[model samples]
Each structure stands twice: as C-alpha cells, then as structure tokens.
Target: MTIELSVLVEEADRFLDAARIQDYCPNGLQVQGRPQVRRIVSGVTASQALLDAAVAAEADAVLVHHGYFWKGENPCVVGMKQRRLKTLLGHDISLLAYHLPLDLHPEVGNNVQLGRQLGLTIEGPLEPGNPRSIVLVGAPAEPMAPADFARHVGAVLGREPLLVEGDRPIRRIAWCTGGAQGYIDQAIAAGVDAYLTGEVSEQTVHSARENGITFIAAGHHATERYGVQALGRYLAERFGIEHQFIDCPNPA
Candidate 1:
C-alpha cells in the first residue's frame, strides 16, 4: 500500500506531538522528496551511511531519530550537509526525524524501550515538573546488585556498560537514552539508586562518586536503536507500509 509523504508526515507529527514542544530542529519533514512513499526506511541517525543504505534499498522515505538542522549546528548546508541533502533530494527520498518526542513517547520511546529490555517497571518521570524530561525513573522487576544490573544492561545492549557502582542495590533506576550524562544530577535528585545513559563525561564519574548514586554508561547508539525500531514496526502495522530499520554503527 502506498501512502502520501504528507500523510506519513502528519501521522508521525501527531504521534510525536511535534508542534506542541520547542525542539532543536524541525520535527517532521526535514527534506522533501516524492509525493508518495512506498518503502519506508528507519534509522537511528540520518548519517551519510544510513542515507546510502536507504538509497541502496530504493527507499521512498527515510525516518530517523536524528536529522539535519540541529540546534547550534552550522546552518550552512555545505560540505557533508550539502552532500547528504543533495543525495536525498536528487534521489527523491524524503527525510523524517523525531528527537525528544521519540525519547519520551510512553510506549515506543527510547528510554521506555531500554527500561523494558532491562526488566524495569517504569515509575514516573525523573524530572517531576518537565513533561519533556528525557530522564525516567523505574523499578526493576526484582532488585539486583548494582554490578549485576550493569552486567544485565551490558548483555541486553551488546556492549559492556561502564559501571560506577554504589553501596546500594539497584531497585530504582533512572535512565535517559542517548548522550544525557548531564541528567545524572536530576536522576540523583529523584532519589534513584542508579542512573543510566548512553554516554559519559569525565565529570559524570566524579558526580556519581560524590552523589552516592551508581552510574552506567551504555553505548549511545546501542541504547537508542530500540525506540525507532519499535516506532517503525508500529507505523508498518498501522499504515500497512513496508518498513525496514537500517543500523549504522556508532560506538559512541
């Protein structure tokens, strides 16, 4: 079945509530292509490799978690940006991206999906007041030692997580998918025993040690792959469209 590009964009925007929030980039269509989309390709980031894969698959549209035109990013579409956009436009492939919305969506969100994989039952948002707070608090299906929990995360995520274990067992955990190391303090404030995110900074180690909260730095790309994949599956089921998730490796 074929769906118009506009229709797909509308559905995605509605699913993500793109217009309601202040986001870093345009949430819906970043680049326009053919009017109708037949084969949809989903990926974590709209990097050149993902675009190349989409082109190789002869995809009509590329749905991604990270797209071009990020805040604080260079506006000039020259060099890599120009090459990427030109390739997509020249091949008539549309680009649809979702950032925070993908992270916070209750069902198919990154944080939610990661928690589920790790056997965590979501309690609430880590940041109490912010609806768009990416950090989430959850309790394990059963309490596990911090080291054991870290190992579980490593096993599920296909990468050894950097563990900064505290004395407490891990019953309540706070997580923010992707490079949200800065949210460790917020997680601590929420009184979570451990905090998990995709990447870690030098300060994160010190913060975790000083604050007495366990910290785990799972691979960024590994942790985030689930949400977009789940969203893609949903779209496929809902729209009866062909969807494929293209994985491009990023160690960080």
Candidate 2:
C-alpha cells in the first residue's frame, strides 16, 4: 500500500490548490523523508508530542494543519525546530502541512467538517466580497438560541467555548478556525448573528458587544482537529494507504 512521496504531495497540492494562494508558511511537503509512504499520521499541529506519537505509530509520513517555518519566523534550525526535524529525519518520516488552504477547502476543510458536525448547512463565504476568504458562514438546520449554539459547539468539539453574548438569536453564523479573532470585523461585516473562532483577543469583547454578534472562542486545537483527519481519511480511501489520526489536545 505504499505510494510515492512525490505522487502523494502532488495529489494533495492539487486537491488543496496550495500554490495559488499566499500563505504565511509553505503549504505542501514541509519536510522530505521517506520516498515511499505506506502509513501516515495526521494531526492538528506538528508539535513534539504529536511527532513522538507518529514515530510510535511507525508512520512513514506525518500530515498536519500546522507546520514549521512561518513567514517571519527565525530560519535557523535550532532548539525546538532542530529537535522536531531531527525526529522526523531519524525515522525517515515525511512532513506534509497545509494551513489556510486546508481551512478553505470545500471538502474535508476545517470549517466545512466542523459545520457538518454542528448540524450547520453551508451558506457561503464569510466575506462575500473577498475572493480568497478562508472564513465561512453557515446556519443550523433549525435556528438555536445563543447559549444553545455555544453548547452545541462545545459538545461537538469537546471543548467548552467562551461565549460572548449578543442580543439576538443565532441563525446565521460565521467561523474560521485557529486564532482568527482578527477576522471578527469581516464576520461582523457579513452581518451574521454570531462569529466563532479559535482564540479571542482583548478587543473581541467590544466587537461582539457593539455589533451584537455572539462570539465563541472555541479552542484552537479543538476546532482544528478535523481537517487533517478528514484529509487523512480521504488519502487512505484514495490511495489505499494506512492513515492514523493522532489527537494532540491543547486547552487554548
């Protein structure tokens, strides 16, 4: 059930449209190791613990939503980066990562998967005018109260979300996973009843209160756990390769 590393990367790149978009970090194939991948480990982030799990699972490739080498990060392979890279190289395991592209993907994307799990039907982009909007808007099949909606998100993601109450019922909602509080303005502009994101900022409260939009800060890791796993599932089915998703939880 081994597939060539090149072939797998190519397929992922094509599926995610990784090249066309500008991202802070490189999208596909962050680290190259084994030429052929028989087993893959997928997770939210490429943290040390997750890498250890991948090694323990004997995974030939490790795929994740978050990977190393950001836009303005230090280029030196020192400290944590060095250790992580060492582990992958030592085990001959490839590192494949996708960030924004994974979030925006129509199928198996973070927002879409999370929305489905929460019984939300997709409406459209959160920012209707932005062609490359990673955030998405969705609605429950039946509208739920603000508090009830928060509970539903917590239940689905297994993380208690911090609810910032708004004045009205939440029918139309928008979300972007993983520390996207900065996009609250876009969500507000979209005129949704509520906005959900991973991390909350100091000003988020003001935004929510002023705009009368319910704000839910679901855990960054919690909200993001699905995209990579979904991609892994797709890869397993498409390529006949074994894939295991290792959950590495983070409270924030």
Best candidate according to lDDT: 2
Give a tens-digit lDDT track for model 2, residues 178-205: 8989999988987899999899999998
| TM-scores of the candidates in the order shown | 0.97, 0.97
Give the whole-model CA lDDT for all candidates, comma-separated.
Answer: 0.90, 0.92
lDDT of 2: 0.92
Q: lDDT per residue, candidate 1, 14-100, as tens digits?
A: 987878878888788999999988899999999999999999999999999999888798799899999999989999999999988
- Residue range with the least summed lDDT across 10 consecutive positions in model 2: 124-133
